[model samples]
Target: DLSINGMWTERLEDSCEKPDEHPTPLTKQQLEQLVRSLILVEQSQELRILAPEIKVLQEDLQLKKANVYRSIPYSRFGSNRDAHCYRKAFPYLLAFKVSCQEWGQVLLRRKEWDAVLEHSLMAWLYTSELPQWDTASHNALREQCYGVLAAHILTALQHCSLEPSRGHELLRRLKMAQLQSQSIVPCIQELQRILGWAQHLDCDL
Candidate 1:
């Protein structure tokens, strides 16, 4: 029995001493494919988790007729008639704003200039769709949103190679926005200046 045990142990030792085979290193293309697959999987998982929350928020916004760009305080049990129910929508509006900003950052990183421009313009349009509230807080929020959009627009315009027709179209959209004229004016001017420079350089060439 001892001799048999010794023989078994020797066999195990020999097996352990043998060199183990290593996997061949992945090719560059294969590694890239793997990374893309991993990214897709992560994005899908994130979507699944966020979808229900998004639906709930959408329903809440619909029910409240909430303007995601505006915030007003809710009336208390014995509050004056001037107080409104806009506070209920504040959280949802905040979420929407955060989501938009995050998406904008992603687009900026990817250098999708056209999409970035469109995104900022769309967000600015949404703010303008609501009535202007005269309160300081409301004015500040509106200006802040406009400032962000203006920055995004400027960045897009500076980086994107826009054709004459596209530049004219952008100008038309900026004109249509009408709100935050100060912010919008600068963006319009910048776009025109960039286009002018491009044309001048082309003429020189």
Candidate 2:
């Protein structure tokens, strides 16, 4: 039996009997090609070019009974040492990174500071789906997401004034994510500085 995204095809009995006994993993060349296709798709905004590769990869993962976003385990003394465990899901994460960056660039270019901040916060919220392993690679990706969030917050402060209620709501969301206080201190300080200056100007009026 072969399944690709819920549509299953029945094979000969002999093939069906041992579907899981020996699943064929994607080759390194195939993986690289898929990643290249993903990059091209993102760059050109052409989904059709990558559709076939996505189907093949999806079928391969389905046969292996693997989740596309599954958390890969790593160990120094085991078969899954390092990010080799990320074999099947590397493209997915790369696609995510690319998409987030592109969105940030577009929003920044438009000077849509509030939209950029919201988009960055949304990306940070999605980081929970990433592998939680303490590996350097995984931590770096998480930090990148955090950096996007923090950078946008500061940028938005510079370009537009945030209402006190909206600012508090943003802080609430960050707290919900359990982000480190230091990571957001610069944003807080900048917001305070702007609000204080606004108050002083109002008093002069």
Candidate 3:
């Protein structure tokens, strides 16, 4: 965790030193990598370095939106709410996916069984949320996070990997990731398949 924090802090330093035409817009891959770093820091249950970084991201995104909406009449008309949503969603999504992945990490560290299954479900929900966004980066990140979390959940759950919270606690975490992706793990798919089979003959999750 110290290593993760140190690396990101260095990346954050490099990012600050660079003077691009605009703050270098974070690419899908970069944002995902950021989330991965956030996850590592969180799982270690150590320092709180991510908050300021998330603020930087939010401020940068807001700046971009202000610039974008100014020239684009259609956006000003509020007809492109999806565009607005997509712009802001990734931070929240990254936070969400990483946090869940962190939870799975903690459980794996603890060797908790049923709770791990629950955390696995939480990861599945995160991935499923990914496709709802129309952005191409989101689509790709969805697939990327989906694949990673699937393997993660499977390995952890093999058998501890699994599932979140009610609204307030969740909103707090979003504040933590500066706000934050989603896709199914096979066990979730398999669980659904089994549930479907059970409904065909009387069983459930």
Provide the TM-score for each candidate, comma-separated.
0.55, 0.55, 0.44
Span of 10 residues, lowest total lDDT, candidate 1: 1-10
For model 1, the stretches where C-alpha displacement exceeds 4 angstroms are 1-84, 131-134, 197-205
Better TM-score candidate (2, 3): 2
Each candidate's root-mean-square deviation in Å? 21.0, 10.6, 10.4
C-alpha lDDT of residue 67 in model 3: 31
Q: On lDDT, who's better, 1 or 2?
A: 1
- Cand. 2 TM to true fold: 0.55
Q: Give one clash count per candidate, in the order shown.
A: 0, 0, 21
Q: What is the lDDT of residue 58 in candidate 2?
A: 32
Give lDDT tens digits, candidate 1, residues 1-205.
Answer: 1111244224422332233532464443543344334333433444444222333323322322243333445445543212143333333334334434554555677788888887777667655544354344644545666777787888888889988899989977876764445687767777768667445433432
The residue-by-residue lDDT of candidate 2 on 1-97, one tens digit each, is 1221232212211222244753765454554454444444443443244222323333333332333344245456775424666643554454455
Candidate 3 lands at a TM-score of 0.44
Name the best candidate (by lDDT).
1
Model 3 lDDT per residue over 1-205, tens place: 3222355435643543344733777776776677677556544554343222323323323332233233222545444436565555545455455554565555556665545544554444444534354445545655655565555545543553223332233223222322222233244444433334335323222
